[model samples]
Target: MNAVFPTLVPDHRCGFWTDGADELETALRRRADVLREAAGEGTRLLDLAALPDGDGAFDAVIGDQCLEHAVTPEQRLRGQHLGVLSRIFARAHALTVPGTRMALTTLTAGRLPRSAATNRALVDVVREIPLWRRCLRPEDVAKACGRWWEVREVDTHQHDYARTALAWLGRLRDREAPLRAEFGDQCYAACLRAVQTFAGAIEDNQLSLVRLTLWRTDQ
Candidate 1:
């Protein structure tokens, strides 16, 4: 791990993977002595459902809460990325050999039925969020993976997500001046707003946090 990503601790090595320009993927790759393609993007990355090519070579794969942010805006509003979600699963399946392990933590949405609509909490709070625009119900994700993997467990982290969001808000508050200085006042304000809204959505059950585990199968 040290040779691959000198800056990262083992705990974060697997869960936190991102290659966006703002992220440190490039800098980290330069620091790596053994790991290759640590900064891969587009066709190179083992991404959020990015990296369309999967070679059935990996022994394990893990991802943090990034899938929601990677989908189209239309899918975000609808509770799943209709056009791209399955493609992501298929690509991932192609990459993983049988019996490989996979884990994913993602933001989830309420499983409300369309016909009997009485819960107004979501309507009152769920506005057009820019960053965390998309969400998936656990079943949707499970179905996507069932063809290639066996579902093992699904766990909810709603309350934890709420607390985590609040903690972020607190940290931003504590570092308001420095954050404003580096990222600008407008950016800081936007961060605050996004966190607050996310916290609220988690509390209202309109948004949730989930962890899912699967085992790649012979199928």
Candidate 2:
């Protein structure tokens, strides 16, 4: 088994290590333990798509809630989301050796039945957010991996996600004044609405968090 070294973590600001990005650095500083652990490990935070290292340099990769933004709105409109996702998988394949394990967590459409209008409304609400791309179905993710990876396990965390969103919503509500002052009333309101929408969607089984564990296939 390959040891986990030089692990690549994409979009680290979402409660992960820093990649020298200002926002990420700030986030890392907030988590002193993670900052210290990363420092001790000598981890290098490199861009997923543009790593300067040679191929097969990493032993593992973790993509936490970042795959949704792999494709642009235009690509999604053109029905190329899967292709874009496949390209990202290919890039990861090139950066890891055979038997490397990758763990990815993403919010995806749920199996629950919802009216077409409701689904359309949800899409409209999130479509304008540059980072909030369309959520993929679980099978779409498997297809995106293609022959590059073997899906080891897939787990759903709908209730957990809903609870977390609710907690965030409560915190935002409690800190309304301070948050609004810092981020502006409009931005704060939008953020609150987005969190509420996600919470409701998760609780209604219209959205779910899927965690996938995959092993890199032999090239």
Candidate 3:
């Protein structure tokens, strides 16, 4: 798992895998005492960008909403996001043996049931939100996989994403007072706008939540 909090230790004694940025590492260090007590030696938090030398150690790799933020907005705008994704796939391939599987979920730009202009507009709106760096199409993802991976399945969950966004929006509205106080009015307003825009895009079929299942090919 990349950038996900491990809630349960593996019962099979296999190590729990997770990685994140430096800020996340610092935050985790603050809770080191509690985490050390709860996780003991089962958890191994690593650096995603520079994974240590452990060839063919992991059975599977899972990343949820991690790929969307893999690169910066500048990289995406410069048409370097696909190259970065390909490199990431290659690195993952080097760490696993043939037949190893990888599952990733990310926000993708939708191209059906809506006009191209509308879809582009929606993408632009969401791209303006903080931490939302990349929003590639399904075809772009497949292209990035290249020879390192064989794509098994690509599933879209626009409705599910819209529902989740709506629920989040409702919660935000309910706690607007405390949230505004904590994050300030401007930050709170930005979050509310971001969620609303995301929900609208998903509802209009302009944006989708995509899950991809891929297998490492012999390389």
Q: Report the backbone clash tally of model 2.
A: 0
> What is the Cα-based lDDT of residue 180 in candidate 2?
72
lDDT of 3 by residue, 42-134 (tens): 223222345556564554656555677687778889999999889888887787655566666677866454467655655555454544446
Candidate lDDT scores, in order, read 0.55, 0.64, 0.61
The list of candidate 2 runs beyond 4 A from truth reads 1-53, 111-124, 127-130, 181-185
- Highest lDDT, which number? 2
The true-structure Cα RMSD of candidate 3 reads 10.4
Q: TM-score: which candidate is best?
A: 2
Worst 10 residues of 2 by lDDT: 1-10
Q: Candidate 2's residue-wise lDDT over 89-108, tens digit each? A: 88888887655677677778
Residues 103-216 of candidate 1: C-alpha lDDT, one tens digit per residue: 667777775534333344333224424434466778777766657767787777676556556655676688789777876776566556656665666777877877776666
Rank by lDDT (best first): 2, 3, 1
